[model samples]
Target: MLSTGGSALIAKKLGEGKEREAREDFSFLTLVSFLFGIAILLIGNIFIEPIVRALGSTDALLPYCVDYLSVSLLLAPAAMLQMMFQTFFVTAGKPLIGLMLTISGGVANMILDYLFMGPFNMGISGAALATGIGELIPAVIGLFYFLFTRHSLYLTKPVVRFQVLKESCFNGSSEMVTNLSTAVVTYLFNITMLKFLGEPGVAAITIVLYGQFLFNALYMGFSMGVAPVISYNHGSQNLPLLKRIFKICIGFISISSILITIMALVSSPVIVEIFTPIGSATYDIAKTGFFLFSINYIFAGINIYSSSMFTAFSDGKVSALISFVRTFVLIVLNILLLPYLIGVNGVWLAVPAAEFMTLFLSVYLFYKKRDVYHYL
Candidate 1:
């Protein structure tokens, strides 16, 4: 929450002091930032296991998690880089470049996934490599165009401002925190599920959890699109526009939640087939569990984006509190309560239960902050 919202806030700043502060010309800076994304994601891919190992919980469950996590983190740096640069471009009135960079990279990633997953015999590592290389491609292209071709909005040079870097980090820290929360929760779930459900159970949870990520990405995208609008309007003191944007964002959230739920349930067998085709019944069961897990999307969408809305306005405490409700407190309750309630199903039901509770939590938080946010 804090990282994501803060990044949006930082985007708000690009419209301020940009010309003089753009120590590097727009082209060079874009290139540098693009490089930064590739570097960061690569770091995440290479270091993820070591970071997990540093926590000192090397159960049998650890190995499997390391493989799945490595693949996703392969693209995380590029994703985060997008967050930072998107703010930069949007503020400069060149949002289209950022959007094109993201969409193109994502499409390329899918193509690479297919190529490496089979014909290249890279297996999991191949998938990771494909995603990582795919992510860097458009970043290269975007940087090339920015540096060699297009006119940047306000940037002038590629000078280092420790302050700008710090601000960018600070602004985007909420996303870091939110994702870190995910990593922690995943760790806890893996360990705990292993204790009760065993390795197969843990694997099942993983497949379902990946489905969760897809749903999360959609909602997060909505937040991403809305963040700039919120930041720009609030900065311009256009409260009415900001409020309208927020309302429309909620609509997006709702629509996504509903669509994700329907799709997951209706397509459960097909979705399951993606990871577990025929040989492994355990994998199939895991996919079934994944289908069950998608039930939480609607509530999750409401709770998460509302938290983001708070952070965009620079209310870090509120943002943190809201995140705590969904990520920490609700999860903890599920961890403690669910296993006792319904056995294996209890474990599967835990997420939806947590999301259900967080929906109310989000509304309450919104109410408490209504006065502060009423102008928007």
Candidate 2:
């Protein structure tokens, strides 16, 4: 949300050819992200134990949670900075560089995960530290790159613009809401599954959802990559080019949704096998749920893109409304009502139902705003 919000403004500024203002806003975002990181670090440390407990960690899990949280908090600022630069880099017309930087960070994370957890035997703390350092590398490198480079977009004199900051926050609220709703929906799914299928049920659901996460990541990356272009064109009032981009993006998402759904169905066994052995109870449950849950991808891509497109257009309220309805309202309703209606299968179908229902709203919003955005 932060990254996209900042990128929307910066991309628009670039389109307007206000290079100095763009750089200043870039600096503002970077500064804000850093301060937020520091705030998180301080608050997290101060209430670490209570926070862990509030998250429902039992006594047995408390020690491990504490260990992980303690190490992770140290890198809070870095994490924030990393997020800001990821999209800002794209706004700067260096999407490939952003991709490379992220890939490098992921590689560093994987390497450190192995070394720290295996050789050093640092346990959860090792994992936390590895992730923290991974984020830190990008944060530091991005800071240096923007600060020292002579690109179209670079960090300049920090001029805190209150109105710009407020707009960014408002524009990004939908993404934040989506994330928060995911957490809430996950909790709801767990409870629903537990009531219907017991402990093994929850485990199966988790494994299947992990597959969804992997596929959703691809959709998210594509949406984010295209967002800046959309914003830039919209800001420039290049109706013809903006319309072309919109058509291409929507077309690609539609095709990919069909392909992803088919792939998930075909690869269900393989995906399930990665987490459990064949013939195990968990394996059987997950395989079944995975197939049923795979139906969601067919509808999810368009819904995800709808919210992102609105954000790029700087229509935060409408974007947030779409996200809230899709991620929270519909999902919650389905989870609560479906299990009772169709038993165990209903639980697995909850997300698919939610996504399918939300697609109508997404399509409606897109058509309704076509005239306004001149992208019909």
Candidate 3:
């Protein structure tokens, strides 16, 4: 995923032939990325049993893992390209384009879900495939549209030099770190759940996490919306307004997080029920998980806001570090420790713990770098 959002950076690097070259280059890069992801899933599927066996997991869980990965092949390209577009639009400060594309893809995904997963009876695999295609389709369209039409930031020279690739990867690391860490934390959640409470524990945690993401999808949009503004203003040395925008954005996130945390606390069961049917143990566990883990937003919102500061400043190192702390460190450590103390229930608190720790670090950094910030 290091190269996941390279399309945008490559677009930025185009000296003359901005859109035409970017479109063509992105088409190739996107295709290659998509193919690589599909290949990973296909090849990874073959080794599922061996990997599970090596882990001493039950055979019952082996099939589930295989099924999940296989189905995920459909989403690989879409998810990858989604990240690519996100970086491009956010870094370029044109998040409206990405937001429009996202909403379209989301709606398309729903339609495909119904057609492929419901009426067609493709089940989970259908759902996965639909979502996968949905992700990549808009990217393809958007890439073409941006390139074919004239724009302020047209791809001047869409050459695929190593320098171009290197820079793209470097610029995209901030977004990639955020996503990769999410995947890592999710794995940690599952592992801790299994160790503490078994399959039911894992299922519950998974559903709760999913419910939180629905709102986060919007938060992601908001963050992307603000990225370019923050970055562009900083580039022009706009400090006061930078602080003002940051304050406004953070204030919005805080209010939203507080509201969501309360909602999660009150309607956790309802939230879980949206994904899992009632009267089943999975449903019960998921509901329980939602109840416990829903308030992670308050902390996560803070971490995300902090990371945006670095991304806006074009400081991938700080962005990555902050992301790693909120995700990898807090999540893994909590999961590893809590289960030993109180059992699977501990996994639910991992997100919040991670968020709080990261928040402390964010505040510390704010004070340490007080003079480094630019006003808008």
lDDT to native, each model: 0.66, 0.89, 0.67
Clashes of 1: 19
Candidate 2 runs further than 4 Å off:
194-200
TM-score on alpha carbons, each prediction? 0.80, 0.94, 0.83
Report the C-alpha lDDT of model 2 over 52-153, residue by residue, as the tens digit.
877545576679889999999999999999888888888888888888888889899989999999999989999999999989888888889998999799
lDDT tens string, model 1, 65-126? 57756766767656544544554555456668777877877788788888888888777777
Best candidate, TM-score-wise? 2
TM-score ranking, best first: 2, 3, 1
Off by over 4 Å in 3: 1-58, 90-94, 155-157, 161-164
Model 3: number of backbone collisions: 21
TM-score of 2: 0.94
| TM-score for candidate 1, residues paired by index | 0.80
Worst 10 residues of 2 by lDDT: 53-62
| lDDT score for residue 286 of model 1 | 75
Better of 2 and 3 by TM-score: 2
